[model samples]
Target: MSTERRAPLDRKRVADTALKLLNDVGLDGLSLRAIARELDVKAPALYWHFKDKQALLDEMATEMYRRMVAGTALDPGDTWQERLRKSSHGLRGELRGYRDGAKVFSGSRFTGIEHAEQMEDTLRLFTAAGFTLAQAVRATATTYLYTLGFVTEEQGVEPLPDERREGYDVAERARRMSDFPLAARAGAEIFADYDRHFEEGLELVLAGIAVRFGGS
Candidate 1:
């Protein structure tokens, strides 16, 4: 087939290859050139499909969102808390599924949507819980941020070697936890049983929203 007749690399093709590259190399090492190289094409060729790295990252985030949205219902059948919790876990799992996926989805204005497709999903949950459109927007933002922050940490994000090591299972971590009463008492609860911690956090955010809104 002629170069003109070459099948276009649609968004999925680009994202799939990018995802592999992400798994192969973390975000800092990722680039349009890397993706193009993986796909056996020139770096400029990627511009035909993605304007830039941010655009490609946005597409990748959208791919993860699509997967998350599929697991959580959009038909408004559950409690807002349930909906929100489901979205939170769905998103966390999506990010955990790919390499450097958490970094890609967390803390960036990929397309500067501050609110994206997942934001709509979150807003729908709020409105279902008896929130007005404005209230839904405001309230959902908090829960969304909380969810993203939780997931980012769940991916084992480190603030500092000494600071972040609290979650690590090293001997130094044990010695430090032993010295602090509260940290010692809560150590197992904090570092252990992530499932319980995530659920507890999910409940706290939901309850906060409820008390401020109506579900209490």
Candidate 2:
């Protein structure tokens, strides 16, 4: 008889399995036990790497950030405005890549300093463009928050890319809001073409930052 030898368990392996299971079961259903089952190990095994569910979530969020940074390459020649736009777009793509991905990342802290390098680079970009240190932090944070909030709502509408929840139909929304003619008509503009809407909204944000911060 032949038997398969499993890879040794570690924090990365545990976090990786949890991220995959996250899509199948979602945040509420994701637990160390479920991850253990996927890894063919006991629940206690996960505790050795992660103290609790929140710790695992922190790791997962960090992993998502790591992957996003790995896949994105910001040109040194790009303006702060261009960098901000590209970074926000890249972040949105990463958050939308998994089920409840934004939710997983939203409130969790990174388990280590792996994210510090990226954070430093972003702050430097803004400061180089003439923003004060505080302003640089704020500007970077504002765009980050916008991307997070946008993707959170986007994922709420469609938990998985292949799956969209019901009750978002434009005609039905319009019918329900028939008494408010203008609001009813707004449904068509709001529910569809998220890509275009995201770009437009991002532009508005960038414009506001430029007006307020005097960045190029």
Predicted structure with the largest lDDT when compared to the true one: 2
Per-residue C-alpha lDDT of model 1 across residues 1-216, encoded as one tens digit per residue: 555565567778888788877866778899998888888888888898788888888888877776666765654566676666776777767776765677788654444453366567666666656789887876666777877776567556332212333446644466787867666666566665566888888888878777787752
Off by over 4 Å in 2: 1-3
Find the 10 residues in a row with the least total lDDT in model 1: 157-166
What is each predicted model's overall lDDT from 0 to 1? 0.70, 0.88
Residue 99, candidate 1: Cα error in Å is 2.6
State each model's C-alpha RMSD to the native: 4.8, 1.3
lDDT of 2 by residue, 1-216 (tens): 659777899988988888888889989999899899999888997888899989999999999999998998988787888888989999999888889999999999988898788788878878888999998888888999999998899888888767877988888999999999999998777777778888998999888888998975
lDDT of 1: 0.70
RMSD of 2: 1.3
Residue pairs clashing, model 2? none
